[model samples]
Target: MRTSNYDKFPFVPVAKAEACQTGWAAIGAALRAALPAHATPGQPLVLAVECYPGTALGPLRQALTEALHPALCLVADDLYRAPADLDALVAGPLTDDPVFGRLNGLTVRDFLDPQKMQVAQATLAAATGQLVLVLGTGATLVCPSPTVLVYADLARWEIQLRQRRGDIANLGSDNFAEKASLKYKRAYFVDWRAADRLKKQTLPRADFLLDTNDPAAPKLIAGADLRAALAATVRRPFRVVPFFDPGPWGGQWMREHLDLPDGPPNYAWGFDCVLEENSLLLGFGAARVEIPSLDLVFAHPRELLGEAVHGRFGTEFPIRFDFLDTVGGGNLSLQVHPLTEYAFDKFGLSYTQDESYYMLDAAPGATVYLGLKEGAKLPAMLADLQRAQDDPAAPFLAAEYINEFPAHRHDHFLIPAGTIHCSGAGGMVLEISATPYIFTFKLWDWARLGLDGQPRPIHLAHGAANIQPDRTTAWVQQHLVNQVQEVARGEGWREERTGLHEREFIETRRHWFTGPVPHDTLGGVQVLNLVQGAEAVVESPTGAFEPYVVHYAETFIVPAAVGAYTIRPHGPAVGTECATMKAYVRT
Candidate 1:
């Protein structure tokens, strides 16, 4: 099932009524304001309405057409390629093995035929009406020219829900990843990717943006003041929509604490910080709507990421934070991510996951396997991995090759890409790293079956190609483990450097205090976690906005526009201290 945490407090930011007004009433008001004072009957008016898959376009089309009489409603699905051609495209070859298997081949171009689309456009253009409503996926792409371009969007999770509920026209009977009995969820992947790509291509050029995330209370972004809305949004502290997924090595920490969906299989990973697959929720009264976090990067890079950083990385949000929990669960698969150049050549990614594990909590004897033993032979290790892969009964000599160190609360273990590592049982780890995360080349998985009751895919060849031989036990100990050192201090607070891995462009620092910590964004974006104590308030020096309250274990961002702010620890015992982990690009 799809998941999101924007509905919960402590994760949602303060909302301004001028920028975010909730409910279907908001959409109705915006639409009325945007419309012309009078409609000329029999005049040609093009309204290109683009939507994600699983949207009930028929109802929307009917509603709009009735509202504007003398209108012609043209459904794009009626113009799609024949059923046989769609089936062939779904089974066609993909650019690579999808990060999420079976969902790779789904794309906008796959389900469409260029010649037929052009013909449909011409046919629609020739027809006469007061309003020509072109509604469906790729509507803007084929409308030739539209008077008003409407990007009607729904969150991926909501779309998935509708698909499961048999509400989507084509995807109703098709199987998704969870319902796949024999093969992969090929059908769902194709539809999902097609909708996703269409939204990406159309949203930027949309004259009016609409949110159907809550079908009961649709919202609209229509006005000459759209830029101001975006600016107002970027100035506030916010969290990306959080989601959870289950895996073979999954734990119960997130499910137990975050009010996540209790499941047949426990939640293994929580996407607390991610951009490519995450979204930002814009809150209005009793209504929350979201846009992909990439929209902020694309539209207002300078405000969110400062001039120096926006110049260096462009629109890319380089820092990522996620959770790796093995508490009351099994060990993670021993893995290494692709090196920088390797990732670009093979996976088309500009970055790699050069990560660090900041332990939140750990049980007795918890361990983390990092780096290789000093004299470990690469060829012998490769042979053992091959044997394990070829014969499931073969032994995995994990201890001989990997150095397992005892883990503790507040410990930070640096793991640059190409280093073999995994978190063992009984620890809750906050994985802070560079943005690219899906390229993990897993070498071993402890011979465990995945949630789908199948063996997870192994990547020995990729791992061997990318593993760095110099990251030995001695090197890891000297350069990676618990390398906390004092950097600066003030009246009642101090700063310490915790993670500054040479391979990563992002660095992490810990601020511990009993009172206020005077700080500035320093011309760059900062992501922070209140890892200790109950609560804290971050306020601007000018008092231009409300004090942003951050709760324990919750993450929030401070945009560069916010210049300077002070962090005041709250709800801690009189003389006790609290701590926060702040991460940002080195620039």
Candidate 2:
């Protein structure tokens, strides 16, 4: 593979005056200086440090205590209900299922004990002539209106890494030894939902925004500066920081092509534009402060995702672009997503995951399993899947029941909800889909152990309920595979409509150009990936925003506020054919 030129740590420069402070001492000093302005004479000053679920509160409280020498320091965890009681409260949302759980509408206050909160309020009312510090996930519940409020945030990806290391537990429970998958499911269903609700209410009013992703090196920025950075971001094309993880069916493609580190066994998944887990870097002078990308969605949904999309999704980013690599590895497990009504009834999701696989790179003889065979019977196929899961020695015989199609470079396979599909070995796929990504129901694995040495979970019952038996080989071939047609052309550029199927709400288009290609967001956000070519540059047509450069396999977003922009081949690909596949919500 050619030498990788991927920009791993992309950041947008903020004003020099908005410099970020590094280290705990500096952060504490800044907060100390700001305390005088908000403090009342002859009264105790309360500093509330409201944290997201995965933040490391121990070190934070310790560092701040030594720096400010607070007379009373309160931990929110001490005010929460006992572990068993908290679990019982959230058991309805965190279902018994291993991988799937219902999205709950619980807020942070629901997790706190009323009696403890009442006592804490009484204590805060009595403290005088001293500095009082309250910190933790539900710290705001104890001290609602503190003299100074600091919101400590960590990205979901960083939280997952911490969970894998057994460094933290779920929000209200102390299950440090629990399986990482179960912990993730609990956080996804219960903790994140509640935390996000609190974050939406408090982030804008926070006096300071704390970056707690790094344990030893914490960064702090003024809340106004952070808000200004986000406002500046929506006027231009930007890329969120990407993260990669290894899996059982991972491959060597990303490690070799993307210049990834060699420490992991293999790279299986690359999250390019999953805003929920990614981070946005804001550069202040030489320092970079990282915050959750979802903050942008919460702060300015209407400007980032247009009026219609905001009306439909309401602060939730609906599109996701990620990579699935199987080159020089094993095949992905056969899986299907739930239908819209099924998703809402069972999982409390407003929409289902409707996705498409665009083959970024495929070795010769690469194939993808899609749809059922022409003569396949639903009962027989389901029985076979059950046998495979029941008896490890019995193989599912995937090729016999599923239709396998040749996967070539740039081939698009539309996978609306309920369509059984998987990418076989020897292919690199860019999966463009809806944001509800973790609802997949696996039907059959290849009887291999996971990276943790346990058998992968299979959801035969859920898969059976959602599978579309009518999507047979002929139907898939006619309507799903390579459904590309020319839409428009100019002197040096042409655009083609790529298939996402009529059932899907995402519309995709492929633009092949050797010169500048014009694009309009059409009153909604647009996401694009440079599928073919080495490099390209995106610029504003009216020079309203700074030019942005992207490399091959890199995904970027243009907010709805950026009405008109142009992209052209740059650097090494200036004279060669460069292609970008763009996806937008269908109006």
Candidate 3:
């Protein structure tokens, strides 16, 4: 790799501790501090040991060391382990220090084989139910045995129902892909209501308009189509906070991108896909922000994202939330996204680039390309990149970037405007961003090809110009929060105000009243939904709190825009979907 005026070594340029959360954050901070200023087989991003949660760790770390990076292996926990095989890391390095003890009077390499990897996984997955491992590093531990269930791309939702007895179905197969070595686990997607209690609702006028590019196209922007698209729902008095399976894609995703020396379908950790908004379209201010599904809003990840559009709106549509389950670790460019000014000046675009990450998994030693490789000389760095474009034996800037980040798990970096960064491969990371599409400026790539069978294009120059050349680290340290609101809480039963959420259209909270309330009291229609273990009765602004869970806990769009109806939770009850939005707030 050649570049003009680049600096090297003396890593610890900035500390990320201020933005950290728990002890893991501290450990994350420490590990980042010790990373080598440059990466080689010998000196890399990972410099110290990191103890992850619940991992038998020692053996896993040894295996990872054999397969991935020894710099990242955690030695805090122990199992009878094999000798560290530098052969896998560096093919011909002579013995320096014996990292692990010998066994059977021979090197542990003589004893360990590929079969042992499978046995270790089976033991871990079974013992550690609800989790699995990725091939090399990290674990997809939350969702287990989730076989293949493909969703038609761009359709908002897909539903499969079984109305009669013995109406059987399956969500994923029993066999796994990749190695084609692991057998599949059988499971079906079904609702758990008794036959007698299950009401045969007409699936509620559901429809989907396939819109991938723009969000404001009348079909997706608002009106009947929007209401109809939201037909998929978890019913009243439900259990387990009904989750979206995101099936098949999980297994297939792991196999393709994560296949490595470790093996596939290794269930590790999972971060919930949070947030719902037209974030991809970065400019022109999105029309309506869907508030009903604001349950997806992980939090106000940033301080500024068009504050005008965030508060009360007397006109226009409501605030909305959107979701994306990305594959091939993109947002992958370690480029600084152009700011509103840069884009407007250059690309005639507008927006800011600030996104929060909810890390689903991080294979061991996955360090993020957080900053420059220390003491980086600016002029030399620029010249070398230019030279690469003209030379053959030289690596491109993007190639150098891939050589940089080894991003780990549960890591949240505040990607403010002008930060050059990227998430590495493996794991599902949920990106919550400002409601614009054009926040990113591509800097580097691992030279990964797209579905188009070509290396994805990069914008290193644009990204370079926008880079915020500052020394800072950690999420919490960068952004300060004055008040942290507990959204909602309860185990068996719940009934209370669900904190607060305000953006243009409506201010929402859990509204429950036992006795009678006047009609058109609040002066808007409210949509009340029953989520779990709760029975609610609504006296139609003019009527009484009805006696059923059918229309009771179900979502009933209050037609009157200026009325208050009485609400009461019966029998150890709680309501999850009990809030309203603008078009919804006035019901």
Query: Which candidate ranks first by lDDT, i.e. highest?
Result: 2
* Candidate 1 per-residue C-alpha lDDT over 164-271 given as tens digits, one digit per residue, 9 for 90 to 100: 555554432233333331212343345654665565567667777677666666666652234455677567666677677777998877766666766547777877
Show how many residue pairs clash in every candidate, following the order shown.
Answer: 1, 0, 81
lDDT of 2 by residue, 1-587 (tens): 45799888888887683368899889888999999899987667999999999899889989999999998999998888899998999898878888888987898898899999899888888897678999999888788888999999999999998898999999889999998898899998889999999999899999999999888889999999899999999989999999999999999999899999989899999999999889999888888888999999999998999999999999999999999999988899999999999999999999999999999999888899999999999999999999999998899999889999999999999999999999999999999999998999999889998999999889999999999999999999999999999999998999999978999999999999999999999889999999999999999979999889999999999999999999999999989999999999998
- Candidate 2 residues lying further than 4 Å off, grouped into runs, are 41-43
Sort by lDDT, top down from the best: 2, 1, 3
Question: What TM-score quantifies how close candidate 2 is to the native fold?
Answer: 0.99
Which candidate has the top score in TM-score? Answer: 2
Off by over 4 Å in 1: 1-34, 37-43, 53-70, 77-93, 96-112, 156-207, 223-227, 572-575
Root-mean-square deviation of candidate 1: 4.5
* lDDT of candidate 3 over 1-587, digit per residue (tens): 22211111001111122221122233223323423322333211222221111112334334334433332221211221232432332212212211111111122122224455455444543532121222211121111121210000111111111111122221111112211101100111011111001111101111111122122231122113333222211111111111122222232233333221234333222221121211111111323222212211112211111124334322212322212223433434445566658756653433444444434345554445554544455556566655654454675564332224444433334445665555554534444344333345655443444332544445556666876544333332333111123344443222333212121123333332343223233433233333222355444444432332322212233322324444444444443333221113313
Per-residue lDDT value at 330 in model 1: 85
**TM-score for each model:** 0.86, 0.99, 0.34
Which residue pairs show collisions in model 2?
A: none
Model 1 misses residue 129 by how many Å?
A: 4.0
